[model samples]
Target: MNTLTDDIDAHALEAAWGELDRVARLRPIHDEDSYDHAVALMNRVLDVMGDNEQHPLAGLLELLATLVGNYEQKHYSLI
Candidate 1:
């Protein structure tokens, strides 16, 4: 099966660097839709985990996840 963490090469990762950068810099995802999009993107990274080949995209995903998680924690923290 195609995985995000499989067969990843520097060149392939470099190719995706721009998109990863954009995602990393994404902000103001205040609505559920935007949050959902981030989640979806994260899930997509997980689903493709084996094929990412150490793709920097994964790092972007992690950063985005952190951002989303931080927002959620502040806005929807449990009492």
Candidate 2:
């Protein structure tokens, strides 16, 4: 069972979440514009994360990557 949520501080989480939301507006990748937006957001996260896999926004970076990847697979998949 995942205990990650068991010890979270709600107030701190809210503030941090708000900050992230202010920086990047993430959503499901769809058309070219959405795909470009996701890529740009991913780059923004990278500016903060660098190569550290344990950074605070690592999960957010991963999520952005997944969104971009899904869109790429749908549109640019190599058969």
Candidate 3:
């Protein structure tokens, strides 16, 4: 398990960041269309990443999912 005290692997960190940038552009969910796009992106990531907590992309997926949920809660009534 990785911890804060663990020594950072610079090359691996750089590759991870690159993957994150490629997968998630990290755009603001400002409108319905943008929110929809975010939802789709999140779904794609979830399909690949699943609920695996140890996966490197898990954090990015969670962040996108949270953004989607927040936008939906604020803009639309939940059924």
Sort order, TM-score high to low = 2, 3, 1
Most lDDT-accurate candidate: 2
Cα RMSD to the true fold for all candidates: 10.1, 3.5, 5.0
* Candidate 1 residue lDDT tens string, 1-79: 9887677887877867767567643555788887888787777777767676588677766777797898799789899
Give the least accurate 10-residue stretch of model 3, judged by summed lDDT. Answer: 19-28
Which candidate has the top score in TM-score? 2
Instruction: Report the Cα lDDT for candidate 3.
Output: 0.83
lDDT score, candidate 1:
0.74
lDDT of 3 at 62: 79
Whole-model Cα lDDT of every candidate shown, in order: 0.74, 0.86, 0.83
Tell me how many clashing residue pairs each candidate has: 14, 0, 0
TM-score (all chains, Cα) for each model: 0.55, 0.70, 0.64
| Per-residue C-alpha lDDT of model 3 across residues 3-76, encoded as one tens digit per residue | 97588888899898788679666677999888978988888888887768788878778789889888888889
Residue 32, candidate 2: C-alpha displacement in angstroms: 0.5
Relative to the unseen true structure, what is the C-alpha lDDT of residue 3 in candidate 1, on a scale of 0 to 100? 83
Candidate 2 global TM-score: 0.70
RMSD of 2: 3.5
